[model samples]
Target: MAKLLALFAAGPLAALAAEPATVAPLTNSGIAGQLVQLLLGLGLVIGLIFLLAWLMRRVQQIGPRGGQVIKLVASQSLGPRDRLVLVQVGTEQILLGLTPGQITPLHVLKEPVPLADAEVATPEFAQRLMELLGKDQKDKP
Candidate 1:
């Protein structure tokens, strides 16, 4: 058993000693290939980040802003008394559909009404809104 172990260790040492180191022929294209691969990977990552940033900016620019007055052009009532209001803001137009009791901004008036008044008198305003919705639904089909 001891002789077998000694032969096994000596066999690997002899094999390693017999193998000689050799160098392959230098190829200039190898460096260029690695450089091209690295550039492509960097460009792909940068392009993806740029696209994501552009999308976020587009999404943020779509919503309403403070101190901006929106004008109501027209409104239409859909089925089941659902109402839609068309308001023109800065350079864009928005459609707001209201229900029986919903909060909406009245921004297109020459004089601004206080928020307290709107909150204090809800029944009258809601009644008027319901009447408007009823009239609109009747006028359309």
Candidate 2:
């Protein structure tokens, strides 16, 4: 009955209730050991987060007939949070106005408009600067 009473009172104390307490004290290996343990735990958590993100990206790439057929042909920013986007869907092309909270369809082209590859290579400012300076890029030193 005393053992049962001791068990209810305390866990390790139940073994020898009559004798002086003889439990071994926890040893501290010091600050360096604790810092190394803390860094390792943080590194593990960060590594797992990156691993999960990479896995999600891989899984998303393998979804629904490879990828999306709707292509963003071009985008022009109107304001800080507003944009005008030209999107190509299958055989049709659409001009969309995108705001902070709303997406409005502005126009739809009757014929498919091809995206000019040259537009990406030469910017408007460079062409204007060349014209003002009266110098051809081909005649560079």
Candidate 3:
């Protein structure tokens, strides 16, 4: 049993003794080179991620098989995080109640309004007021 224990200890000691005499010391240039390589790799990964995101956005803009079936007609903010929206899906117009967690259909219009007519009818009141005020000020000058 003692001879077996001695053999086990000797085996590890012999392995340590056979280790290389010289080990290359780490230099500043080597560390800087590794850092540069690491940064370049990280930058490449980030660039690829951004490129993929941009490609996805471009693909999404091309749209689906049926073209744009759903169009947003108008949106009105009820609160900080709540809104009332009118959406035109195909030939139907739907009023939707939007909240942070839920979206509920409020009403559906019997007669669907045309997109061009809706755009012509809904003028921005604040923008019109601002334009009028600007015109009045210019006239006085």
Top TM-score: which candidate number? 3
RMSD to the hidden true structure, all candidates = 18.9, 7.8, 7.4
lDDT of 2 by residue, 15-90 (tens): 5766786879778779999999999999999999999999999997787754678988989999999999999998
Score each candidate by Cα lDDT.
0.70, 0.87, 0.85
Off by over 4 Å in 3: 14-23, 27-39, 58-66, 114-141
Tens-place lDDT per residue, model 3, 40-115, is 9999999999999999999987868458799899889999999999999888999999999999999999987656
Clashing residue pairs found in predicted model 1:
none
Cα lDDT for residue 32, candidate 3: 80
Cα displacement (angstroms), candidate 3, residue 81, comes to 3.0
**Of the pair 1 and 3, which is ahead by TM-score?**
3
| Candidate closest to the true structure, highest lDDT | 2
Per-model TM against the reference: 0.34, 0.56, 0.56
